[model samples]
Target: MTQETEAVAEEAFPQPGPQARTGRPPRRGRALAVLGLLGELLITLGLVLGLFVTYSLWWTDVLADRSAAAASDQLRDSWAAGGPAALPSGSPSGPAAQGDPNAPNAPGAPVPGGGPTSGAGGTGTALAAGTGVGFLHVPAMGRNYQVLIRMGTDADTLAEGVAGVYEQPYRAAMPWDASGNFALAAHRDGHGAKFHDLDALHKGDPIVVETRDKWYVYRVDSTLPETTKFDTGIVAPVPKGSGYTEPGRYITLTTCTPVYTSRYRMAVWGSLVRVDDMDAKRTPPAELRRG
Candidate 1:
C-alpha cells in the first residue's frame, strides 16, 4: 500500500520543476531588486553632476587664467621690443592737440606736423581678427589687473581673458584717431572673470589703453549697470543715452552682468582725456599709476 500510494502522489505533483519551486521570485524580493537598481542609477547621476560642477567652476578658471597670462606676457614683450618714442617736452599747438588736455606738451606749446604722432602710425589700423592689439589697464579693478585687447568679441576670443573691440557698423577708433567710439567687450564671469569687478569702477576712474607707440587715457564718465544683451545702441558711435551731445572720441567697456549668467550686459563709458607717447621706460602715465 505504501509503495503504490507514493508512486501515485509523485505522478500527480512530479516534484515540481525548478522554476515552479522558485515561483517567479517573491514579489517583495522583486521590489527590493528594483529599488537597488534605481539607487545605483541615482549614485551615478550624482557623480556626473559633481564632475560637471568641478569642471565649470574650478578647472575653467585655472585654464583661463593661464591663457590670459600668456597673452599678456607676449604683448608686453612685443611692445618692449619696438615701441613709440618718448613725448617731447613742450606745449603742442593746433586743432590736433586741442582734444588731449593731458598731453606732455603744454596747451600753447609749438606743435610739429600737428599734435603727438604715434611711431606705429596715425591711421590706427585694425589688427587682424583674434590677434592682440594692445593691453587694457583698469586701475580701479586691481593693481595687477590687465588683459590683452584682441580684435574679435566672439566667445572663443574672450575665453582667453582678452577684450575684443567691435569692428562692424563702426570701426573702433584708436586713441590716435581724431574722433569715434572705441567699443570693447569681455566676459564678466568664468574665463577668468576678466571684468568681474566692472561695477567697482566709479566716475573719474581711468581706463588706460597701451599701444605699441602710445598710451590713451580715458576717464570714466558714466556707467550702465544693466542692459539687455541685444542692445547694440550702447556701442553706437554717439552711444545713445551716454550723455554725449556731439561726436567725439569715446571708449566703451561691455561685459555680462548678474554674475555667472549671460542674461544681460553692463557698460562703462569714458571719453579720451589724452594721448601720451610711450616713454623710454614704457612707464604708464600718472593716471594709471596705483598709489
Candidate 2:
C-alpha cells in the first residue's frame, strides 16, 4: 500500500529541476536573449549620445571661447610690443615719398591714381597668411565682442578663435586698401563661433577694423541673410547684388547660417564711412560710438 501510494504521488508531481530548485526562471530563447541584449545596448548608446551633445554644445563653447580670448590677447600684446617696422617710401598707404605730394595716402583718401590705397603701413604689409592682422569689433554683436582677423580663411585658422580672410579664388581686401572689398569669414557656430549673431547686424551698424595704426570705420549697408555655401559672390571685390555700382572701399563679412550647420552662408556688407588715426590710447572712431 505504501509503495503504491508513493509511486502515484511522484507521478502526479515530479521532482524540481536545477533552475526551479535555484528559484531562477528557465533560460530564454535565443531571440529573446538577443532582444534583451539589444535593449541594453540601446540604453548605453542613448547615454553616449547625451554626453556627446553636451560636449558639442556646451563644453566646446567653453573651450573655444577660452582659446579665442587667449589668441586675441596674444595679438594685442604683439601690437603693443612696437608693431611692424616702417614701410619703404611710396609703399602702399605708407608715408608720402619724400617731397612727393602725390604719394599714396591713408585709407578713405584716394591715391594719386584714384581709389583708396592699401593702408598696410610698415608691418601691415608683412602680415603673412594665417597671421592675425587686426581686431574686428561689431557692436551689434556685443559691446565686448571683438575677434582677431587672420589672413587666411581656413578651417584650422578660423578654429583658433578669430575670423580669417579668404585667400583663395580671391584674396580678401584689407580695409585700408582702396576701392575693393575687405572680406572676412568666421564660424557661425562652434569653434568660437565668432559671428553667430551675424544676422543681428542691421544697416547702419558699425564694423570697426582696428589696426596698429588706424581704425577703419565701415557702416553696414546690406545683408544677405541666407545664401548657398557655393555662393562666393558675397566676398567678391564688388560683392554682386550689394547695391554698389561704383567701386569703393567696402567690407564684407561671411559666416555659416542656420546655426550649428554649414549648409548655407550669411553675409553682411558695409562701405567705408571714414577712418581715424589710432592714437596712443587707441581712441575708437566716432562711427563706433553708439547713442
Candidate 3:
C-alpha cells in the first residue's frame, strides 16, 4: 500500500475521465422537458382565462343589451296593442298616488299598479318571471340611460340585462305605489350593467320609471355604500336605514359593490317626488331633460 502501488491502481481504473459516458439521458434533461411542457400548459391556461374574462365582462354585455332591448320593444308593442294584461289592476286613486304618502290608509283603499295593498300595498295579479314591467331612466347615468325592468330577480331573469322587481324577499311596489319601497336590482358591471353608474348617483339625482301612461320620478334621497348580501330589509315595505321614518312611494336600486364583484351590495334610495302624466311623445321629466 505504498504511493507507487496507489498510482498503479489509479492508472488501471483511468479515473473514469471526470464522468463515465452513459447511453441514457441525464435526469436533469428529463426534468427540463417536464418543466417546458408545464410552461406551455401554463401559457395555454392563461390565454383561456383571458378569453373567459373578456366574454364575461364585455361580450356578455353586448348580448344582454340586445336581449333587453328586444324584450323592451315587445313590451312596448304589447302596450301599444292595448293588451289588458299590459297594465296592472287599480288606478292612481285614493291614497295610492294622489294622496299623501304618509296619509293614513283607508281600509280597502285602491293601490296603484295593483296588488293587495300591504300597508301601502296594491292589488294586481302576480306577473310571471321575465314579464316586462317598465323602463327605468337614470338621468345621472346618461341621456340614454334606460333599461327594461322585469318581474323576477333570479339569476336567469337578471341575465337578460334588465332590472328586476324584488318578488322573493318582498313584493316590491309598482312605480306608482303610494307608500311602499319599489325595489329593483340589476347587474353592476356585465349584462348591460344597468346600475354600473349607481355609485355616481347623489342626493337629489333623478330616477324615473316609465309606465304605460305615467312617469314616476324619484329623487335620490340617500345611499348605502355597502351592506351584507342577505340584507333583505333593503327591499322591505319600508326599507330600514333608508332614511325613511314612515311609508312613502320609495324606490331602491341595488347592485354589487366595489366594482365587478358580488361580495356585497350597494343601494341608492329615492322617494317619489312627483308623478307626471305621459303625453303621446313620452317626454322625460324635467330632471331628465337637464344636462
lDDT of 1 by residue, 1-291 (tens): 699999998898698775688777578677989999999999999999999878876777789889978887876776677653222222113244464544433233233556442211122333567777788999999986788888878778888778887776456655555566778998877777788899999899999988776778899999999999888888887786689877777889999888888899989999987778777888889976768
Residue-wise lDDT of candidate 2 within 98-132, one digit each (tens)? 22344343334443334543431201242467676
Minimum summed lDDT over a 10-residue window in model 1 is located at 85-94
What TM-score does each of the candidates earn?
Answer: 0.74, 0.80, 0.83
Selected candidate, larger TM-score, 2 vs 3: 3
| CA lDDT for candidate 3 | 0.79
Off by over 4 Å in 2: 1-4, 15-32, 85-126
- For 73-98, candidate 3 gives per-residue lDDT tens digits of 89888878877543442234645356
TM-score of 2: 0.80
Taken over the whole model, the C-alpha lDDT of each candidate is 0.74, 0.73, 0.79
TM-score leaderboard ranking: 3, 2, 1
Stretches off by above 4 angstroms in model 3 are 1-25, 88-123
**Model 3 lowest lDDT segment of ten:** 115-124
